[model samples]
Target chain A: MELVKRLLSGDMRAAARLITHIENELPDAREAIRLIYPHTGKAHVIGVTGSPGSGKSTLVDSMITEFRKKDKTVGVICVDPSSPFTGGAILGDRIRMGNHFTDKDVFIRSLATRGALGGLSKATKDAIRILDALGKDVIIVETVGTGQDEVDIVKAAHTVLVLSVPGFGDEIQIMKAGILEIADILVVNKADRDGADKLALELTLMVDLGHEEKADQKWKPLVLKTVATKNIGTPELIETIERHLQYLKSSNLLEINHKKNIEREIIELVNEHLINHLLGIMKEGDFEKLIEKIVEREIDPYSATDEILKKLYSN
Target chain B: MSYERKIRILVAKPGLDGHDRGALVLCHAFRDAGMEVIYTGILQTPEQIVETALQEDVDVVALSLLNGAHMTLFPRVRQLLIERNAEDTIVCGGGIIPEHHKPELIRQGITGLYGPGTLLDVIINHVVERVKKERWKIA
Candidate 1:
């Protein structure tokens, strides 16, 4: 309880502890968040995503370092795949940014997907809000690059960086359309590797082709090359991001997008809270009976749904 | 009813590196061992992880890290657990944890480290034993 109070008051330890409590999905964690939910919504959210092995982590580490150089506080949320069998997060991704653990200015967290179909967790948005409320100047969300679901989650960010690397071959094809559309900036990471230029050219052509399709869309996503491992070209990448941010601000898209994000978040929170509450009230035997009826074809899912809705509405 | 309660484990990938085959496999192995596992979907801050541990009221917090950021993330989570009086929760880790970092991890309060090729059964057995010990202590 004191930790919750401290978290609301902007205590870093309490914030960190609260985040862990939420990730673990502890009951008290929900109460703590409910208590502190009113104080969130100030940090700039940046989503970085790319194909597997595209150096997204390295790029994010570089960005955090750059943000720190400016004396800005940052939070990084690294999303890793959950074990499909056990429904637990296998948090192997944190090894890339090992150097910043002690840097008071940086707070990094990892989440395992827990069988969330889209490679994004339900708790992600709330976790972001917690970090935002904790007063992080910039909050970076790094998602696993596993097709459409991941791309959709990253689009929630003010700036989305879609990363690609050489030698990925056909996986690039899978990423081309879904992730490409949302990318504010395209990064050709691992630039030291051969084919980096070729990939960049291919990406540029793809973006051009997409623009041609969109016709009057004025915003053309910028493509940049970087060797994230060595931290080369990170400064230019950051500058491009800043320029894009300025563009969004000038065009007034920032406020519009922010408002939309808030609206979507509130809807989702209410929906989640309502569903959880209803489920809690349902008796286990009642759910089992419904399942049996469905299995026995005694009731169609549509009818069953109506019945369940009636029951939920009544209570 | 002689039903065995499934050991609930929370496996978390901390930091930004995203390779997760090892974590996935471990989750499968744990499930096969009859454990109820709650995966904290990816990019969880240390706070999210601790929160999940408490909320789920899980038996263990098993983390897998290939990216070298374990040094900071692990200790911070460990410290946070202590602060929350949840230090009784067993914290074990695995994945490409470098040989040199073992001493530091153990010293910093990680209960155990499982490297590549360590059998899931072995890890499960160890966890069962550890959890039993913890329960005995509490009892």
Candidate 2:
């Protein structure tokens, strides 16, 4: 509670401590989230995701500068890959965005996926909430796209920018329905390279064709090209992000998205709690015994689960 | 019950040093050792390093300076951390620091003024042991 109070009072130390608590899955993390939940919903959550070598980090760095030019306080949650061998991660977001290290308005933190399939830690949402409560005007969550984790991570954003470099192989794979459904803006980074125009054109045609199937779609995703390292087209990218934000507000989609996000979070929390509680009630020996029985052919897993469920409800 | 927290280290390159290969290698080393390493890339002012160490609440602040500014830069960070009442954070450095300056640097609160040829295992052990002693101290 003191941490929450200090966080609400704009203490960066307290905010960092609370984030550590969340990351470590400490006991009072739930209390901190409950206290800070009401103070959120103000920050514009933008997710930038792309394949490795797509210059997403550089793009994010450029976007941070553009956001600051508009006098907005920005918080960045950069998700980095964790070592599968050691269960550790190197958070290198600061390396790319080091110029803003001295800027008080820009607070950047790196998160390890920690083996989370969504390219984000489970505590990422709480971390975002803490920044939002601290009154950040824009919170950018950046992730490296590999699979479903990227898609899941982008769900936290109001505007999702999917970046791709030329020659990433198979434009059709890039324009899959799952990817297209999540992208509010498509970017072909490294536009100075060869095949940049071909890549952008392919993406544009895909977006246009995708829209024809969903006739009721009001917002059209704009495919843009950028050389993120050179800071080219960043202003236009920011403008497009702002436009999307405005569209969300004017159409009242912002409130709808907020509600949907909270709903998803609650369901996840419920599932987590239910499983934790059930496991807590069942002794380790009993669970292992069930496994041993299945191995010995005395009982199938289905019946073992049924028996456990019956015990769970009976007492 | 005291909860065990991850050892977070801010591996920073202060001053005009542009060679980040060593700093990045150490970042990977610390991370592989299971400590969270926040690398403050290159060309960082002392003020920026201290600020990041404070905000990140890191257990250690390791400076990697190859630009011959260790005496001026390392002490500046230690002083800032002291002024901010974060004296508990272990301050250390590596990267071409001369032997004669090691004593003064340590006297000024830098624990590990490692130079070239210091093994990653040694640095990792030093960090883990130093953090254990300081973190569990009954203040």
TM-score of each: 0.72, 0.94
Clashing pairs in 2: A118-A149
Q: What's the residue-level lDDT of B56 in candidate 1?
A: 45
**What DockQ, on C-alphas, does every prediction get?**
0.12, 0.60
DockQ of 1: 0.12
Q: lDDT scores for all predictions? A: 0.75, 0.84
lDDT of 1 at A181: 73
lDDT of 2 by residue, B43-134 (tens): 88888888788667788999998889999999999998899888988998888888898999989979777777789999999888888888
DockQ of 2: 0.60
Residue-level error in angstroms, candidate 2, position A60: 0.9
lDDT of 2 by residue, A1-315 (tens): 899998988877788778878887888988998999899889999998877768878999999999999999998888887777877677777678877877888888777777777667776888999999988999999885555335876558899998888887777676565655688999989999999999899889888987899998878999999998899999999999999999999999998987888799889978878777776788779888999999999999899989888867976
Least lDDT summed over 10 consecutive residues: which range in candidate 2 chain A? A144-153
